[model samples]
Target: MFDYIIKNTSLPEVGVKNTIQLLNDACTIPFISRYRKEATGNLDEVQIGEIVKFKEQFETLEKRKATILKALEEQGVLTPELQQKVESAPDQTILEDLYLPYKKSRKTKADTAREQCLEPLAKIIMSQKTNDLESVAHRYIKGDLNSVDDALEGARHIIAEWINERTDVRNNIRYQLERFATITTKVVKKREAEDEAQKFRDYFDWSESLSHIPSHRLLAILRAENESFIRVKIEIDDDRALDKIFQRIIKSNNACSDQIEIAIKDAYKRLLLPSLSNEALQNAKEKADEAAITVFAKNLKQLLLGSPLGEKRVLAIDPGFRTGCKVVCLDAQGQLKHNETIYPHPPKNDSTGAIKKISTLAEAYKIEAIAIGNGTASRETEALIRRIRFKNDIQVFVVSEAGASIYSASKIARDEFPNYDVTVRGAVSIGRRLQDPLAELVKIDAKSIGIGQYQHDVDQTKLKTQLDTVVESCVNAVGVNLNTASKSLLSYVSGIGPKLAENIVNYRDEHGAFSSRTELKNVPRLGDKAFEQGSAFLRIKDAQNPLDDSAVHPESYHIVKSIAKNEGKRVSELIGNSSILKSIDLKVYCTDSTGLPTLQEIVKELEKPGLDIREQAKVFTFNQNIKTINDVQEGQLLPGIVNNITNFGAFVDIGIKESGLIHISNLSDGFVSDVNAHISLHEQVIVKVLEVDIPRKRIQLKLHK
Candidate 1:
């Protein structure tokens, strides 16, 4: 396993060994990356995650090898050479190929021929030493075989099966596919006229190198095929494939060689192409799934780690057209103080009454910010709110309404607000999202957050696993407040899962707020292991022990205290004293367990303990001239925020119904390999409209330098 990870990743063998051991010990990724830096050789979460991935892959491969070996032994074919081959198989594909001939299944042509005693005839023809093939085949003409031709055909079937079972033939075909396979599609004639089929029109006549197709395009084509709108075909040069097989199998120039050549062609078509082509396609699909999942995970991480507005009283509005904008006021802690409706749009366009209500509520609640949902009347709502002259300054923000409804209708939302409707809950979510994106966004599904590309078409299980990892990483990266964090947020902490998170919340409700990190031991089922893994990621504000509120683990509190004593100051006085921290030698503090890495991290933490790694959320304004796609034009410069990113491009929400796409080529003057490097989620930038198709509601943009 260590060698496999070392070969696959750039990590050293020792680092891989230690990381696997830590994972085997049930250490969470965030905990190991942050707290056990010394043991992991200062490996970050991603590098440790690579070790975990390769470790699981190696374990899976070993389990598969065991299963194959057991099956071979049961079949009475586990010879020394075969056992060695099976045991030495490095991956699942190779192991499966080794066991293919012995695998039991329903009857096939080859099986019937073998049952008819044609194996001897197959071997006779396969040798290609005899020119009188007809004479040799005549002896097998009995029972199921009525004539010489029938005997010869049955022998050919057996020969084809033998050739298909040869590992070299399959590997050669796989090599051909890996290098030369092309994916092509044609419209399903019957379904081509259907309304739903038009969505995949771009794919009807598409052809691309299977290995080079972008993950999004491949997934889209596969989706089209799944939807019955297109017939997808994976193709390679048949002549080239046959020639390669011929080179390996056709040894002589005779009637026997001719028979073997026929068998090789049959094997190539009937057995080899279908099975291996499908394998190649499956391999491609898995790759596409992995790439798409990576994109989704990155987007989810960025969205979760978006800048926070922090603890501020906020007035939130879930904008609407006719139902009236649902308004809610939240205190600094994101607790709802009041809820109501304001008719600021549509037939009930009582702008005067709406503005007056907003003004009065802002002053009454001491609102520090106004959050307007970027949905149906978002622009009008923002316009209406901006018209108001409040007594105190309030920064106004347009928050994405994606998944707000899902969160509002969730059980978590219902439990928090039993009397309020989904609208009120949704408004409160928007407000809280502005306050802390990581905290509030965790309540909703990551997919529904509208940051993924082809998320639905990818492998759902893989996508979920990766997104969960990202959420966990982000949640732990920004330490959760033990006293005030929601259950959803706490559930993602290092060792605390759903059950323990709920237990902690229940315990907190029963016994007020926690005074120290050690109090986590009192929560039910939060054992020593759980506390050790989780306590560092759970911060306590204004705790009795200052280290409890910082990222310094309780196990390391003595280290910090020792440093403070060496400095001739109290722990509190030493905290945030960067001058003293810089002057201290980290090497002097290194012990058998702790190393220079952990000591350096400790000193860095003492300098700015529990400080947010994210920037403060800032107010952004959209161009007031554009309220709809009709108002947009080519070559118009508009301020936009990057709302989504794909390998091909980044989509920017330009304050209109249609979000403009900045193609990867347009992202930079040189080459752009990664979209995230050029732009990130929710990054505000100026964009120039290069093209706009009003009929399709499509807009093309270029990054304004």
Candidate 2:
């Protein structure tokens, strides 16, 4: 099944062959791609993902052919030639075409003609030898065929059914439709005045070549058609299709040939066109689905790998207007130290009291930074925090609060903090996201993270599979801390699942901290296979052996120990000693099981053991003078952070509740194709306001060069 994937996906043969074995053994993609780099020839998550996807498709194609062959055998219609054809068919479309003639159907003209014993007459006319059409029809007009016209019609019905069932005819017509069809949509007359329909006004009357239509446009048109707001269809020139049909079926242009032409027209109009149209549409949709999923996966990867403000004593705020703002202080390890509420805005504007409380908390906790949720009353809360005269310097960040609410109300959150209310849990999540995005974001569902478009409308199963693969890749890339990581975060690690993760956490709680990577085997249900797949990506700080604190897997400890012994230094001294690592030849330790790729990674790990792959978070502030859209004038430049991205543009949050759009056309001086390729989620940039519409809550902006 993976033969097609290996040849097409550009991965080395041995790598794909070995990786398939690991995948068969239930190892995850992240584990194979990261820990088993030698087995995959250093193929990253994208190639691995493609291989898995194509392998599944190939299996499905094979299964469908099996079912069809079984049905044919049961019907007593299976022959040596037909069985060979069915078994050799490559794709589902062609396989189904082969099965069409044998499929049972409702009563039709062809069935009636066969029952009347006029099949022999139909066969005679199809030979196209005699030009006497009326004479040929007269022979079958005795019994069920009442007259010459009835005989001719019944014969034509058989001819038409024969034409419809020909594999060549259906394939040729489908080729024409796929190459030359145009998709057109128009608003339904009765639904034009509907308020819900107004959202699709731009597609009220739209027409475009199917080949040239973009994914976003196609999905939008499909959504509109599904809602009954528009009538959508695909069309090809009728004469062009007729020319292809005539070339394939008609033999001569005499009187009898006219009857053949009539059958051709009836077959196409009654059967071929509708079937090919549906096939063309299905192909277009699959293309569109793959495109949308690609965009979504890229955006999700960026969000998961966003910058982190590492391990800080911080203050978090989930600000609101009517309800008082929820405030919480977290220690360096993200443990909740204190919680309170302050009314700093609107009706109960306790500015003086809020300022005093904030300053006192900052001094007492030795807060290094402030993480304020980017939500209602956020900007106002930021202003109040800035005004307070703290005894120590603090960096202020506006963290995206997209899925904090969902996490706060989750079962995991309740389990983690049983006594805290949702508000306090929400604030803690905001602070923790700044400290480490990959660790915190994994707790909530990736779909709720606000990065993808039309997520709910795409194939839910495919979406979940793709997103899960991405999350797993990100988690394993940045190794986890065995003692400090949460159950949700640990569950995403290479081989550990929810149940294994719970056991690990329970073991830690019962048996104090893990002092070495070797201790993972002591946990129940974690065998040698689990340890091999996961131990490399699990880091233990201050472990008994220095290699345990690095990404060098336990299986390779002997090799690292050998290098250290050759250098006449302890393993601890070899770690972070670039001078010593530079002199050793890694090729000396290479074996078939431990190739150059694995050895190279080991040397790199020695140089910088247990390093975080992500960058440190930077503090950003919106224009203080422009708190809302009403205060913004055209052409004013302001600082902002990218909040959401789509096919057309990226939305930049400018400190108010609403964000502004930076369309693809305005991203640069030259033409841009994909917005995500140029920028990313949570990226900070400067922009100049293009236009603002308070009525629609829309603001247009262009990037400041």
Candidate 3:
């Protein structure tokens, strides 16, 4: 397994071995990446993640090999040569091919022919050494054999099955599929004029090389096929495919060879084409799924790590037209202080009343910022709020309301605010999201947040697994506050799961806030291993020991103390003192187990204890003149925020109902391989409108340099 993983990942053998050992110990990825740097040779989370993926793949391959070997043995055909072939097969394709001939299935044409006593005739024809094939086949005129043609046809069916089972034939055709196959589609004739079919009109008559098709396009084509709007086919050049198979089976031009030729064509169509074509297409789909999942994971990570607004009193409004705007006031710690509703748009153009209510509420709650949900009536709400004069300057921000409704109806939301309805809950979510994105976003489903690409079309299990890993990485990267983090956020910490998180929260409720990291040991069910894994990622502000607030683990406090002792100062004094931190040689503290990587990390943590790696959230305003898509024009420069990214492009929210797309080509004049390399989620940027299709609600944009 180690050799297999090393071969696949091309990582250092020692690092791979140690990482596997740590994984065997059930250590979390974030913990191993951050705390076990010395043992892992300083591999990052991604590299360690690759090791984990390849290790699982190797295990799955071995399990499949074992299953195949057992099946072969049970069939009484487990020859030593066959056993060696199965054991040495590198991948699923080859291993399955080796077992294909012996696999049990529903009675096929070949099975019927074999039942008709045609096995000897097939072997005779396959040798292609006799000119009187029909004469030889006439001997099998027993059961179900009416004439010489029947005997020959039955023997041909057996021969076709044999030709299809050849490992070399399957491999050659698979190569052709992998290289030259084209995925073609045609609109389902009945569904051609339907409304849903129009969405995929571009794919109605589309054809692209399977190998060169983009991931997004392939996923789109597949989705179209799944919806019954299109008929999809995988094809390769027939003559080229047949020629390759014929070269391998045809040894002479005798009557037996002619019979074998007929069987070869039948095999190529009936057995080989369908089986290998589906395999090739499924492989392409899996690759496309992997690519799409990667894009979604990256987008989710960026959205999770978006800039935070810190602790501030906020007034949030979930904008609506006829339903009015749901308003909620939250304190600096994101606790809901007040909730109400105000009609500020259309039917109830009660601007005067709404302004008075907003101003009075802002003053009463001492609101420092306003977060307006960017939904229906969002522009009108922002305009109304901007007109009001407050005693203190309050920054107004338009927050994306994506997935807010999902959270509003969730059980977690009900647990947080039992008395408030979903509207109030949604408003509060918007306000809290501004205060700290990672903490609040973790409460909602990552998929529902609307930052992914082809999320539903990808493999759901793999998508969920990757998204969970991203969430965990983000949560650990920005250490959670021990006393204040919600159960959802706490659950994502290194080794703490939902149950442990709930227990920790319950313990905090029973007894006030924890004072230090050591107090975690007293929590129910939080054993030594959990504490060791999770303690460093949980921060405690104003703790008795300053190191508790920083990322420095408890096990390494002795090393920090040693450094302070050498500097002739207290541990607290050494904390954040750059001159003192810089003067200390990390090499002096390096022991056999504690290397420079660990010591260097400790010093860096001491410099900025419990520091936020994210930037502070800033207020953004869209064009006051452009309220809807109708106002947008070609070549118009506008400010927008990147909301979603894919392999092909980034979608920007340009202060309108419809977001504009900046295709990968428009990202820059130079070639761009990764969308994230050029733009990020939630990044404010200036863009030039390229085109707008009002009917389709689509807009094209180019990044403004």
Candidate 4:
């Protein structure tokens, strides 16, 4: 199974085998990738992730085969040949087709005929050598078999069942479905007049080949069908399906052959077409689900790893329309210092009071930046902030408040701020996000982040797993600050879980701050294994040993000390000194346990200790003159920021409530297969408005040089 899986996966056999062993030994992906590079042959997080995926798939397939074998034995049909076939099945679909012939079901036409002693007649007719089929069927015209036609009908039912059970027939039908299947949808006539159904108007009469339909379209059509707003089906040409089945079953054209023909047609409409069609639909839906999840995972990874502004005192606002804006002042460490509300927009229209409050907060808390929520009245709030004159230079930014409300009402938020309201928690979140995106975003559910396409329709379990993988990768890539990091961020560290994370936080609160990474062992339940796996990715600034603050693992501390002594310098002298680092021989440090890959990363980490892999978050403002969609004119180039990314394109915010879509076709002059290849989340780019539909509230944009 491992060999089979590795053949399809990107990992080599040795790497996959060693990684599987490491995972079986209870190692996390990030831990193995960073710490066990030699054992895994330098496989990164992505390859490790694939190994985990294929491992689960093979386990599931094996488990399914076991159940089928047990059921066949219980049914007294466990022949050596059948058992061998089941045990050696390659995948779930093939295993199922092999099991279909003996599967138990409710009493069908075939079962009735078998109970009436017509099995011999079905057999004779199947041979297609009998000259008198009616005469043969006449003898069976007793109890439940009235006329020759009745007896022959029952025999046909049995023969149809036999044809349906044949592996070749089913496989041929499946092959046809794979090549020529089409998905068609039609609106439910009664539901078409309902207001709720209008959202799916574009899919009311849609038809497309299942082989090439886009994932977004398939998900949308399925959503409509799930809502009972439309009927969707997978189909292929009926003649093609019948012909394929005929080539496998019908062997003659005599009276018995005519009977076989009748059975084949019955087998198709009753047993084959419906089954294969459903299988095709399910297969397509699963493929669509996987594609959607991949897109979502990519978007999430980009969003979570977005640039951070580092430590700065910030004032954040959760903008509102009628209730004014909720504002909070956060210190450099994102600790809330004060909260207040200011009305700069209508109905109160107290611009003077709002401007005075803003200027006062900026000076009072020494706020260096301002973050306003990109929600209702966001543009108005931005305009108001631009007009305010501060004593010192302060940059203003608009942050997406997609999941602010959810996070505000969460238990984590409540625990963080027991005395403050949800609105205050929300405002502080925006400010903190500007300072450290991964730290702040980890506190909210990935589903509510607004970076998904049809997230709810995809498999929730798979989505959660994929999103968690992304978050873990991002958190480990940017080593966590042990002393000041939040519990949410620490939970995503290599070996630390939610319980251990909370324990670490409690210990920090009681002991003040973590002076060294070794102090993690003092925390309850943080054993040796956890420390070994997690310490390399957990940093403590200004620690006693400089290695604790670097990505250098504690297990390798002796190696570094030996080298430092040999060079007649302290270990601290070699840290981040590229001149000295380039002079050291990495090969001399390799051991039976450590190899070149591990030694190489050690050298790189020393060059830049505790480096943040992400770019620096910059202050971006949309076109100052263009404030709304109405102001957008076709062919006018404007500076914009890519806010959300999808497989089809990216949505760019051009100082408007509705972001403009930059379709993939316009991403480049040449063909573009992936949107992320050209654009990224939160990237700054110039775009020209291609089209605007005010009534529908849509904006189309194209990339500009």
Give lDDT per model, in order: 0.92, 0.87, 0.93, 0.89
TM-scores for all candidates: the values are 0.99, 0.96, 0.99, 0.98
Q: List, residue by residue over 1-705, the lDDT tens digit for candidate 2.
A: 656776567777777777788788988787777667877878877777777877787889889988988999999999999999998887788899899988866888888989988788888778888878788788777776689889878888889989889988888888888789999998999999999998898899998998778887888889989999999989999898988888887788776678888888988888888878878987898788777877788888888899999989999999998999999999988999999999989889998999999999999999999999998988899999988877878999989899999999999999999998999999999999989988999999888988766776678888888888888888899989999999999998888989999999999999999999888999999988888888888988888888887888888899999999999999998999999998898888988888888888889999999888898998888889988779988999999998878887888988887889998899988999889778888889999999988987889999897
Ranking by TM-score: 1, 3, 4, 2
Give the count of colliding residue pairs in each prediction. Answer: 0, 0, 0, 0
* Range of the 10 consecutive residues with the lowest summed lDDT in candidate 1: 10-19
- Error of model 2, residue 440, in angstroms: 1.2
Clashing residue pairs for model 3: none
Model 3 misplacement above 4 A:
none
For residue 281, what is the lDDT in candidate 1? 93
Model 4 clash pairs?
A: none
Distance from true position, residue 184, model 3, in Å?
0.8
Under the 3 Å rule for N, CA and C atoms, how many clashes does model 1 have? 0
* C-alpha RMSD for every candidate: 1.0, 2.0, 1.1, 1.3
Summing lDDT over every window of 10 consecutive residues in candidate 4, give the lowest-scoring window: 1-10
Clashing pairs in 1: none
Residue range 1-705, candidate 1, lDDT tens digits: 777789899797777788888898989999999988878889999998888888889999999988888988888989999999988888888889889998858788998999899999989888889888898888888897899989888889999989999999999999989999999999989998898998899998999999899998999999999998999888999998999889988889998888888898898889999999999999999999998898889899899999999999999999998899999999999999999998978798898999989989988998999999999999989988888888888999999999999999999999999998999999999999999999999999998999868999888988888889999999998999999999999999999999999999999999999998988999999999999899999998988898888888899988998999999999999989988999998788889999988888888999999999999999999999999999998999999999999989999999988899999999999999999998999999999999988988899999998
